[model samples]
Target: MTFLHTIGAIFIFAPFLAFIMFVLLSRKKLKRRSIGFSADLTTFLLFISVPVSVESLWGLEISFAVAVTAILIAIFLLVIEWKKSKEIEVLKYIRKTWRLYFLLLSVSYILIWATGLALTVISFA
Candidate 1:
């Protein structure tokens, strides 16, 4: 139980741990299986990590952040789609939104990680 919790926390905090694990296990087989699986897995983990990272960095509740992030992405995609074709291309927009969110969350995760490290150093100093 405790071990499982630790593993869960590690995955939540690292974001790409599971993705890396998969890639390592897949090795050459991963090429034949396709790179998309790794990307999709990282993206899914980012969905959880963004809010967790925010909360850890700020010591504030970010439970609603995930929902808000998803909603905002949807709205932004809708706007882009409207500009692109002025119609609901559900499949296209959804895929675009997921990719965009991955980039956005990846940036957030890096920033948060840096901030945390800086804060730790500052506290020591």
Candidate 2:
């Protein structure tokens, strides 16, 4: 595999490993907050990985696929958040950690998309 491919693999898979760790470590606490955080993290990783995997296996353009998947996931999350906004308890925790959540999502997408863009550019070279 090339250097770009290796970086792409890491960008796609690292979150998955972190998710597993979150699950394992949170078993002791097992609170709703931890569970919710883990779920959101998992969702984010899944959203990022689907397109990256498709591009890797099928030789599709990464930038377009990643962008589409990211937008779709953002819309889906927004809808879910809107529907659940009435739940004060859930909203409280979500609001408290919203920054962290956004940061994670932003970083993951940026890394994946950057790697994808690099790979695409290399392919055309």
Candidate 3:
């Protein structure tokens, strides 16, 4: 792969790394602040990367698939939280993190689109 492709790959998979870090730190209870940051960053990255990764891998046209996946996950979490008597916690979490989600989603969409445009221009030249 070229340097651009390498960079794109890193951008695409960065959230997965953040997720691993979050899980590991949370498990060991090593750093609460870092864990929170990682968790939030992971969610943001996943929201962005999932669609880009899907498009890149499958050449699909739909972008809302990631949103659907997120909704499904939220529903699943809601069910679990309901059973635990924390029914509103998921909504609260979404409210708190919605900005991060929106920012990442916008940024990731732009980055992926720019990369694709650049690649197209390069190919045509």
Candidate 4:
């Protein structure tokens, strides 16, 4: 269904899409630390998106419970990070590799978005 495809696309690309938005806005100040944070955040969100999207399509499922558990775990991790935010290590190669990371992340998400759109269009056709 079109709705299903749209939801799938969103779940797949939402985190990456948001990351690109943030990265573009922070281009000048995007340090190695920020890129590291973005990478971790992107992985975490994608992990969550899987079960959440499954739940959305199936009404209710065990995956929904699992997704909630994962969310709680993510929250716990975030809380820990917040307390020790100043202790996080800075990436040495950030200045040199930040552009590459940004480019890859952007390309990956764009591809994901395009795939979703294609799925939606195909489902309707």
The candidate that wins on TM-score is 1
Candidate 4 residues lying further than 4 Å off, grouped into runs, are 1-13, 25-27, 57-119
**Candidate 1 lDDT by residue in tens digits, 11-90:** 88997777788677676776755345665667888888878887878877775877797798799779878987867878
Candidate 3 lDDT by residue in tens digits, 11-102:
56665565676668676655666555565656666675757665774588556766775577657656766787854675575754454464
Candidate closer to the true structure by TM-score (higher is better), 1 or 2: 1
- Report every candidate's CA lDDT: 0.79, 0.62, 0.63, 0.55
| lDDT tens readout by residue for model 4, 4-113 | 98865764647767456555666668665665556555654555554554455444455556556545654565566558674633353232234443444445445645
Clashes of 1: 0
Scored against the true structure, residue 119 in model 4 reaches a CA lDDT of 72
Root mean square deviation (Cα) for candidate 3: 9.9
The candidate that wins on lDDT is 1
Better model by TM-score, 2 or 3? 3
Q: Please say which candidate is ahead in TM-score: 2 or 4.
A: 2
Ranking by TM-score: 1, 3, 2, 4
Any runs in candidate 3 off by more than 4 Å, and if so which?
1-10, 16-30, 90-125
TM per model? 0.80, 0.41, 0.45, 0.37
Collision pairs in model 2: none
Candidate 3: TM-score?
0.45
Q: Candidate 2 lDDT, tens digit per residue, 1-125?
A: 69988765674655566566777788778865675566566656655675565566567666575566556665666667668786546565455445444455556655665777788999999
Q: Pick out the ten consecutive residues of candidate 4 with the lowest summed lDDT.
A: 92-101
